[model samples]
Target: MTGRPATTTLWRPTGPEELALVRALDWRAWPPRLPEQPIFYPVLNEDYAIRIAREWNVPHSGVGFVTRFEVRSGFLSRYPVRRAGGRTILELWVPAEELPEFNAHIVGTVQVVHTFR
Candidate 1:
């Protein structure tokens, strides 16, 4: 196994603002943000995901959703980490053109963990 850890190392929790993008994707995955938004921010825990969904998304759009998915641990080293208001958020700096490649690293289907409406 190349001596790599046989374990799922990272699960990113996200609140997709574009619900349609989530529905339209193959894995219910979040499509990469626009080129203008070069950083794809995914938090490290479900609680923070839920909080963003409930606090920001629901209030702004009257609907909120939280999704969780496993990603290749090897990719973690490429990004920078930030602590935001009690949340551990990872900054995946994927330019818009490279999104397809990023999506391919996801290990499984993205699961919608919660909905606040």
Candidate 2:
């Protein structure tokens, strides 16, 4: 095996409020999901994330951000990938309670790859 850890790239479309919380965590982890939100979805592709950030998040919050990160493949395998719409619109449905465990498997710091306003 190579020295690098086996990981899968994931992207999240977030609003300013959520991005601020991520920043407060030093970009190391995502904040806990609110009670009403039962799932924490991280999309499989950047295109879907960008679409959400621009279409949904921007309209709701006035600004949005697309963040990318990597997570250990082994840790991610326990959860099934879900297709929300088109073929490319795929995501991992991590239950809110399991989010802490999910965060623990992140391979590196989360990054803001794109922003929309």
Measured by lDDT, the strongest candidate is 2
Residue ranges of candidate 1 with Cα displaced over 4 Å: 1-17, 87-97
All candidates: CA RMSD (Å): 3.4, 1.2
Q: CA lDDT, every prediction?
A: 0.64, 0.96
In candidate 1 the C-alpha lDDT for residue 13 amounts to 41
State residue 55's C-alpha deviation in candidate 1, in Å.
Answer: 0.6
Compose the digit string of candidate 2's lDDT tens values, residues 1-117.
569889999999999999999999999899999999999999999999999999999999999999999999999999999999999999999999999999999988999999898
Q: Candidate 2: deviation at residue 33, Å?
A: 0.5
Residue-by-residue lDDT tens digits, candidate 1, 1-117: 476443233334434546567678866356767757766776766677777788888888887877777777676556556677644543344456656666777776777778888
Candidate 1: TM-score?
A: 0.74
Clashing pairs in 1: none
